[model samples]
Structure formats: structure tokens, C-alpha cells
Target: MKREIFVVADNIFTPLGKTTAENFENLKQGKSAIKQHHNAALSRQPFYAALFDKKEFPKEDRYTKFEQIVIASITDALQQSGLNTSDEKTVFILSSTKGNIGLLETETHTPELFDRISLSASAKLIAEYFGFKNQPIVVSNACISGVVAIITGMRLLRTGQYENAVIAGADVISEFILSGFESFQALSPGVCKPFDKDRDGLNLGEGAGTIILSSNPKYAGNIKALGGGISNDANHISGPSRTGKELSLAIDQAMKDADLSIGDISFISAHGTATSYNDEMEANAIALSGLESVPLNSLKANYGHTLGAAGLIESIVSVQSLKDHVVLPTMGFEERGVTRSVNVAKSIAASSKPNFLKTASGFGGCNAAIVFGK
Candidate 1:
């Protein structure tokens, strides 16, 4: 039989809060981190996003903002897990679409700093800082990077390659990313409204999130990572699949891997990027998986589209909801948007179910689904 993998500890550093608990509290209170920004470097027009303050993170000349947040998040998670980062059996994984990419524009004075622009370089730097024995693994897959990272760690642990895996993901909002999204007209003029008929586009955000998965059940707090699956639409580089068929396959496979059924999932933590295609695509996928009635909420409404950190942070919140037996509302959602009807959580509600599903789809038509249970 495959080894069991459990999520022992996790933390998130975002504009919402510094710790997982703080972020959850703010979420429960219906607070969102998204706001309008006037930074000329980020955008010529006022853009909506969730950004952490400079003072909120340390200023280290050797570390970029991305590195600082990743280190901070993973350190807290490792501390809470009581796992030694230096342990030989502990592996580190970094997930991000853009790691220290901003260094390209700002570090021109130090041409050598150009090397830091590589994702692998940033991961190695972090691994060295924490004294990790293994070479750090970096996952740069579009938006699904976080979930893919977790799935990667789970598979590694199942092979007995590692006893503990520290998976962390983060992506900072930069002028390059902002301009790219603007070019696609994918940026919302205000806070995104997932699954709402009036929803237009997504708001970009930045944050770091870390989740520690271990083979030891003793470290399992209230949730375990049961099974997950990943698939690509191979339809578009930047657009999602026209039909939700590809993503539906991922959801179905994850359920089968976990020995679960539609009735077993009490809620769904959807990607809910609020873009016309993404929301509709996810709706069709959920319906195809026969989970149309499962109550669902999108963290995007609370955190905006955090890109790399989206999956990890959103999964952490889903675990919190399962533990608390409460379903957080789909913030900013007022009307149905997709063709396939879904039970979008309009208000906070109590639930006794023990299992939840988290699904994410990103650029390049990548889709991932992970099943978790308390």
C-alpha cells in the first residue's frame, strides 16, 4: 500500500495577515486584502491587488522580496511542525511562476545579480539559508505550481525518498506580470467577484505560503492530504480549456485515488479566478465530476489571484474551514455567472462533513485537484 501523507503544519504571509490563524480570522470576519494601487511602476491605470507592505517583511540586501517572504513563511511552518529543516530526510520545494524576476530591472548595478533571476538559484539560496541537506526543488508551472508542489512532495514521501517535505510557494506582483495581464485584459477594475454574473477579470496579488507534509501521522493536525491529480488541456498556452472536460478528469482521478465519491466532498475550494473563461470552465468541471451541489468558495475573492501561492494558501484555508466546520462565503459574489449551476456559498454556513476538495487551473491549461480529509 502507498504510504499515507498528512499535512502537519502550514503558514501564510499575506496582506491579510502574517500567520495562518491571523489570515483565517480575517477571512472569517469577511475582510479582503485586495485594493486599488496607483504605483506607476506597476500600472499606468489604478489596478486592484493584494500586496504586503515593505515594513511587514525584513529588508535584507542579499535577499529579494520574494526570497524574504518564502523564508519567513517556511520558517514559521517548520517551527510549528517541529521538523528540523537541517534533517537529511527533509526536502525543500519552492513553487513560483516568477522568483526574484524583479531583480532583472533593479539589480542592473550588480550584473552578477542576474543569476539570482533564475528560479533554481532562489530556491538554492533559500535551501542553503535553512541548511537543508537536499538540493531544493523548484516548481515553476503557471498558477498550479503550489498544488503541483504538494503533489510532488506527496509522491516523493510515498516512495520513502523523504520523511518530511517542506513545500512553499510565492509570487510577488511585478511590473512585468502586471503589464502582461494588462495586455490580456485580464485585470479587474475592482475587487474580483468570482462566479458573479458581473464578474469581468482577476486581480493579481502577492504572498507566500508553506505547508509541511509528513509520513508520520503524529504530525497531522486536523487534515491529511489523501490524493491529488494533475492534467493539462494542451489547448492554449495562456487560455484555459474551452470545455471543463480536462479539469474534470483531474477531479475524478483525485477522488478515485482517495477512494472518495461526490457525496464524500462537503465543499470545494475552487480556483475562481473570476475571469469569464476560468469560472465557467471550473463550473463545468465541477458539474462533470458530479459535484454540482457541493458548496464551494473561491479564495480569490479574499486574496485575489495570488498565482503561485494561490494553491498552498487556499488549501491551508480549506483545511481551516474543515476543522472549524464552517464554510466561508464567496466574497463579492452576488449573482450566478456560469452556465453549469453550482452551489456557491453565499453566506457562512455550518457543515459536519470531514472531507473537502481543492481545485486549481492555471496558464498552459494545467489543472490540479487534491482531496483532503480531517
Candidate 2:
């Protein structure tokens, strides 16, 4: 019997705030977290990025700079969830491209030092923090890591393997990731402007987000998984397909799983990376869905591209938009870059009622779509 999963409390550590509500408000107001990085921690990169202030994360674990943020965010989510961690049956799943690569970047000459930054390594560290007994699993699917973790959690719950789960995704800024994007020419010199005529590339941001899920009828979580769909483009490892076929398939599957039709969808949370391929592909997918009137928005402009953490962070933010009854605008959009049949939101509103589709495409020919509603 596949039990249902409901999100009780979700929290995010973003440039916007230490809390999910604050982060959503920032995104709704069209706030951009893509400020220039001025710290001395990163010296090899030439481009600026939206980075978190170290002083703001003193409560985070010191093992790595990112650990601290994830831990703090987890604390907030769990506090809001009112989950009983003492149950011992709760599982932990972490999604991240480079879980603790910050430690590995320093150990390049010593390959064995990779253990220090392994995905499982950091997951164990986080599990211990919550006193969780189960062996935590790590989902390292590049950019799709977060949504993949959520999907994995839903499966576990539906399978009756675990009564509840904590889904956490996080990635911190490091020379390792910075260098990778730089090598790919995916880093924007200034703030990212998604779906804009002159948009260049994505600005990177770091943060962790956690969602607590449970099958218990008593759980107070608002949004349920309803249904989600996932697929890979196979067009390229790093770039998306020209036709957006795979992305379209993912959305179709999710709606099917929910037993919903295209007309049932209200809006979409776009992956809007501000990169030429990402935004174009997403816009085309929305058009193919035949919901051109449905509004679309992106976070790359507000929080930069958070990589793995983006899946959970953005999904959690979507829920906030639903719960808080506010819709944030996409910042940095001046002119439409693509000739698509979709409507791009130019302003934020106090409230909206349409179901939200959170779509994410990543570096490994992987993609995922999650639909949520009140």
C-alpha cells in the first residue's frame, strides 16, 4: 500500500531569510539575492555571486560552512513541523550536487580525502544531529537532487517502509562549483535575468531547505504530493533538448498521476536559470502544455541558481506562495527573449488559487515536475 505524503513544515536558509515565509516574501517582492560576493573565501573565481553572510550562520555546524546553514534550516523546519523525532521510524534523505565538496576541493591532491566530502558522509552528520537511527540516504543528482529526494521520500512513505521522512537539500558556494560553472560559461557576471532578451547566465546562491513529511492522519501539513512526474531529456548531459520533449513528458506524467488535466493546472514555478537553453526550453514546455495563460516565474533572478538545494528550496517557496496567499514577481526581466505562447508574470499579487507546478531540469539528462495545491 503506497501511503500518501503531506508536507507539514518546510523551511529555507536563503539570501532572503532564515525562515521560509521571509524567503517567499522576498521572492514575491521580486527581491534578488544575487549580490556580488566580496568575501576572501573565494579567490579563484572572477565573477560575482549571491552569497550568504557567514556571520548570519554561526549556529550552523562548523564541519563545513554549508553544514551550518543546513542544520539551522532543519532546526527551523522541524520546529514548525511539530514532528516527534523520538519515533525512530523517520527517515532522512539529502539531495545535493556536491554534498560536501568544500572539503574535497581542499583535498584534490589527496584523492582518498574524498571521503571527507562524500554525500553519505554529510548525511550521516545530519542524521546524528536529529538523533535519527535509520541510515540516511543521499541523492546526488546534480541539479535534480532536491526534487529527486522529495520523490524518493514520497515513495518511501507510499511503500510503508517509513511512516515519516525528513527531506533536506543543500549546496554551498565553493571554488569547486564556481570553477565548474565558469568552465561551462554558465555563470552570469551580474544578477541573472531569466527570460530576458539580454539575459546572460545564472548567478549562484547557497542555502538549504528541509520539508517534513508524514503519513500520519494527525499530521498538520497542508500540501499533499497529489501527484508528480519525472523524466530525462537525454538530449544532452548539460544542456536541455531543443524540442523540450522530455520536460513536456514529465509534466504530463505528473498531471496524469494526479488524475488532472491540463486545464486543472493554475501556474508554474519555472526553472528560469536565465541561461539561453534553460529558459527557452522551459518556456517551450509551458507552451506545449497548452496553458499559455498560466503565469510563470523563476528564482534564478531572486536567489541565483542554488543548484541541488534549488529543488527543495524552490518547492518549499512555492508552498509558501500558496499558504501566504501571495505571488512574487520575477526580478530582472525586461524583455521577452523567446517567442513562446506563455505569459510571464510581470508583477506580484496578494493571492492566487491555481495549482503550482515546480519544474526542475539538471545536468545529468534528468528532470522532475511536482504539483501542489491548497
Candidate 3:
């Protein structure tokens, strides 16, 4: 029999709150952290985002903001799991689209700084802090990094090479990030509205999320990582596939791996970035998978787009939703704007099904899907 992987513990650290429970509570109360900011350091023009107070984290010469959030999230998850990281069977996987990229603003371009900005180096430093015995793995596949990291960890555990996997992802908002999106005109002027008719663009946010997965059955009831699938559209460098068939392929593979039928999935946690193309593409994909009525919601309005941290944070919320037997609404969604029909959640509702699907798409035509269940 294949080894079972369960979510032993998890944590989400964002402007909304520090802990998972706190974040969930804030979501339930319909509170959002996104607001307008006039920070000249990030952008010349005003922008909207969910950002942590600069006072909360003082200038630190040791670790960058990205690393600091990752460490904080992993620490809380480890504490909750009570797992010893010093063991040889425990491994760490770090996910981020941009790690230490902000250092370029202050530091000069030099060969010595190369190693410092490398994602692997950041992963090693974090692993050493927690005393992880094995070499750390790093995933940097655009926005799908977090889900890919989880899937990679699950495969590693199934290979019997590791007993526990500490998966965490984070990215901090910087001038580099904001300007890149701005160049593409992908930033919404105000709050984002996923799957809504008036949805324009995505709002950028910064945060971290950590999930610990173990092969032991002792961690069972919380939820299990049933299966995952990844694919690429090869459509455009920054744009997703126009047809949504690639993402549908990924969703099909995940369901096949999980040994589930369409009816088994209770709902979908979409990667609804509130961007015009992304939300529309996701709707087409769901319809392709015959899941147009699955009742899905995007958490972008609650937390904004956390980039590399989005997949993990959204997955954590999906788990919580399943456990609590409620599906949170897609905030700011009013009318259907996509070409295809979709059951875009408008209000909180009960969910009795044991399984849920999470999907994500990012730059470079990458798409990923994962199924989690009781």
C-alpha cells in the first residue's frame, strides 16, 4: 500500500493575523487587510495591497523580510506538530517566486552577493535554524510554487526517503514586484473582485504559510494530501493558456490520483487572482472538467495575491473550511463575468463533502491542482 500523507500542522502569517485560527476568524467576520498605500519606496503612484506594518519588523541585518516570515510560520507549525526536526528523516522544502530579491535595492551587484540571493542559500539558512538533517529543497515556479512544493514533499514521503516534510512559502512585496506587475498593468486600482463582472486586475500582498506533512496515521483527521498534478500551457511567457485545457488536464490527473470521481469533490478553491484572464480561464477550465457548478470561491479579496505564498495559504483555508463545514464566500463577487457558467460562491454555505480541490495558475504557463480530504 502507498504511504499516506497527512497535514500534521499548519500556520498562516499575514497582515490579517499571525495564526491560522486568527486569520480564519477574520475571514469569517468578513474583514480584509487590503487597503490603499502611498509608499513611495514601492511605487510612485498610489497602490492597493495587504501589507504588514513596517514597525512590526524593524530593520534586520541578519534576515530579509521574506526569510523572517518563513521562519516565523515554520516555527509555529513545528510547535503545533511537536515534531523533532533534528531527525534525519525530517526534510524542509521552501517555496518562493522571489527570495532575497529585495536585497538588490540596498546591496551592490557582486559575485559574493550571488550566493546570498540564491533561493537554495535561503533554504539552507532556514533549515539550519530548525536543525533539519537533510538538504533543503527549494521551489520557485512562479505563483504555483507553494502547491508544487507540497506535491513534491508528498512524493518524497511516498518514496520512503523522508518521514516528515516541512513545506513553507513566502514572498514580500518590493519595488521589484510592484513594478513588474505595474509594467504589465496587472494591478487593480482598488480592492480586487475575483470572478466578478467588474474585476480588473490583481492586488499584490505579502505573507507566509507553512504546512507540515507526515506519513504517520496519527495526524490523520485534519486532512490528507490525496493527490496533485502539474502542467504547462506553453501558451505564452506570462499569459496562461487561452483555452484552459491545460489546467483541466491537471485537475483530471489529480482526481485520478486521488481515486475520486467528479461527485466526490465538495468544492473548489480557485486561484482567482481577480485578473480578467485568470478568472475567465479558471471558469473555462472548471467547465471543461465538468465542475462548473462545484461552488468555488477565491480568497484574493481577503488576503490579496500573496504570489508564492498564495497556493499554501489558500490550501490552508480550504482545509479549515472543510473542517468547519462551511464555505467562505468569494468577497466582492456580484455578477458572473466569465464566458462559461460557474457557481461562484456569493455567501457562506454548508459543505458536507469530505474532499475539495485547489487549483492555481501562474506566469510561464504553469498550472497545478491538488486534492485534500478527510
- State the lDDT of candidate 2 residue by residue for 1-374, as single tens digits: 33567888889988788898788767766677777665555645456677887786565344677767778888998998777775777998888888677765555646566766677878888788888888998898878788888888887887888988899888888877787888898888888888999999988888899998887777635677766788988778778888877888888887776676776665678888999998888888878867678777787788888888998998888887777766667788878897696677778766556467888888877878888765
Tell how far residue 280 is off in model 2, in angstroms. 0.8
Full-model lDDT for every candidate: 0.91, 0.80, 0.93
Worst window of 10 by summed lDDT in candidate 2: 37-46
The reply for model 3, stretches above 4 Å from the true place, is none
lDDT (tens digit, per residue) of candidate 3 on 1-374: 67889999999999998999999999999989999999999999999999999997897667778889999999999999999999999989999999888888878999888889999989988998899989999999999999999999999998999999999999999999999999999999999999999999999999999999999877766689999999999889888898999999999999998888889888999999999999999999999999998999999998999999999999998998999999899998999999999999999999899999999999999999999998
Q: Which one wins by lDDT: 1 or 3? A: 3
- Error of model 2, residue 237, in angstroms: 1.6
Question: What are the per-residue Cα lDDT tens digits for candidate 1 across 1-374?
Answer: 77889888999999999899999999999999998888887778888999887686566587888999999998899888888888999999999998877766665646567666889889998999999999889998999999999999999998999999999999998888999999999988899999999999999999999999999767655578889999999899888898899999999989988888888888999999999999999999999999999999998978998899999999999898898999889999999999999999999999999999999999888999999995
Q: What is the lDDT of residue 273 in candidate 2?
A: 90
Q: Which run of 10 residues does model 1 get worst, by summed lDDT? A: 103-112
Best by lDDT: 3
Candidate 3 lDDT for residue 173: 93
Candidate 2 accuracy as lDDT: 0.80
